[model samples]
Target: MSAPETIAVAMSGGVDSSAVAALLREQGHTLVGLTLQLWNQRRLAGHEGMPESVQGRCCSIDDVYDARRVAEHLGIPYYLVNQEERFENEVVKPFVSEYLAGRTPIPCTLCNNHLKFDALLITARQIGADRIATGHYARNHYDEARGRWILSRPADRSKDQTYFLFGLTQDQLAHTLFPLGEMTKPVVRQMAADAGLALAKKPDSQEICFIPGGDYSAFLAAYLEDVGEEQPDLSGELVSTAGEVLGKHAGIHTVTVGQRKGLGLTSPNPLYVLQIHPESHAVTVGSEAELMGTELYADRLNWISIAELTEPIRVEAKIRHRHEPAWATLSPAGEGLAHVVFDEPQRAITPGQSAIFFQGDEVVGGGWIVNRNS
Candidate 1:
């Protein structure tokens, strides 16, 4: 008889990951459930605008308790691995730095790339597990023909999480599993209920786990105060795209590209933020048409389907998580950079966000948006 494979399941105490544990255990796999304690919600609580209660956030103590309950129900060993310091350094600090630099950063992507997979994979191996599994809605398979592990969009397209998973390396892909990739959120919830797991109706975590109420600006203020560091000066002039100064703004940390509100100035036609200059601290505003662009440059590239991009390839590029893939031509610009020219203009191509390249459902590669030429 064959021995049951030892697998570490990253349980978030939510229905999705809990369902993953249930399914894997049913498959006769020896499970070691791990919940990474990424952040302490109570650390900065009671500070200005920060919530004391740790409800609705990921990796909360309440969540750890729920994960323990699920593991106890499954009759498996469960452990909480403290990664607060690493999470703050790799995910939280970078998020704050990018925001203060007048760029929009996706903390979820950083968390996945740095903590969840990288740190979790190391912990899984140390604990005698061969592979780690999670509930992310993304598909990965070993492509024998291409001799590379390929990541693809999951069956549940709406819940597809491959956009944030672009940083996963080939080795990481080989050692990871996504059991809930093919299942939809509704189906997973139903399965959790069928398995007699609590939290079957727990709502999906939408806000940044460490930041309560989805307020990055408030979180930044509170976080800076907590660390005993003064908030960097973000006050700058609101300028037009033609370098015409329109008005003086409070700070750059409060605004993002494509924002139309809180400009504090009246105009004949409604204006939108075109770009943010971190060095000069200038926020450019213009008409909605100015937001459209057909070309962008991406750096720090990671290729999944192919080993290296030697020549120009046709791909559908996605600038945002919800963005529909647009037909584009991708060419190598230089080392660790790619030039993407879209067939049609994309709107509000913000910097610091990911630009993922896709061919059909398979992920070709992706990189960080650096600059765009409208």
Candidate 2:
């Protein structure tokens, strides 16, 4: 275990976060539960399919109550800080705009980077906390030989969350901790149950906390309407690699790289989404073969080890959130871009996504995915 430090745990009123606090408590770390109210409390009806108390999602009264209950049960101090304006500026607006521009953005990573880790970590420091920890199922290791903190896939490979953590800077990794990293999800649940924690039996949160019902497009539509902004004609052309027209699409936000079904297109065989040019508002479709990509370029590179990459490094690359990693040679281009040439032709390398590089179980670094080619 690392040196004993005062830890402020970010409790999301979920089993994972609750379990994290419980584990830290058992290990004798001082705990202060912290949750954020990221949206207006009144009129939550826009969020559908939530628990009775969630109203319309965002920071629901139910969530705050649950977090407070957990904190009290554990005999720890709790704080529900208001972060609505920050969330609006960083997470919500960017989500809507990305969809409008025709990309399936992963807002979880954005929230973790901007709101949860960065902003929340800053706030924790202001309160005299030594470090911030989360319930994420990824491990952070301090390698004395390398003098660095290494981000690695947890023992629970099935639940590894390194994909979303690629945005972390070296400094953040040094100060952050993940309590459930070495344990499997079932084991985590068992520990909570053994400890008689209420969250031990709680259902895992599946939908995005903010968009409960899961009609993200509708949420975006209504959100845009509230701001009195006219909806743009986000329609685009669906074509094949050879410039053959296939069908029409409502918007690029509705599709992503390697999407096979739900295209509303009927052909002789199954068709897949291969390319999305947001600039020209064109979506190229073809067979699964067309989705194969060999090269990827990324921006906003943040290296966890070696500080920077002056030459190509052999590592594993994961293009999307859930996809299995593939072997690749990663090279640092001039100024800041990292060029990833996959050993095998990967499929559906979408822009506006992330490409996380790994070395064995350790995360070397990653950045925003862009300039993909098949």
Summarize candidate 1's per-residue lDDT along 206-240 as a digit string, tens digits.
77788888888889999999999999888999999
lDDT on C-alpha atoms for all candidate structures: 0.91, 0.81
Worst 10 residues of 1 by lDDT: 1-10
Candidate 1 runs further than 4 Å off: 1-3
Question: Which pairs, if any, clash in model 1?
Answer: none
Tens-digit lDDT track of model 2 for 1-374: 65667899988787788888888888888988999878664434543322234553434666677778888988999998888889989998998887777776778888877787887688789888988888899988778998888889999899999999887877788888888888888888898777677768777666676665676766676677767788787788899889988889988777777888788898998999887887888998899877788998998777785678988999999988888999999998776799999999987887778888999998999988768876
Best by TM-score: 1
Candidate 1 vs. true structure, TM-score = 0.97
Alpha carbon lDDT of residue 1, candidate 1?
12
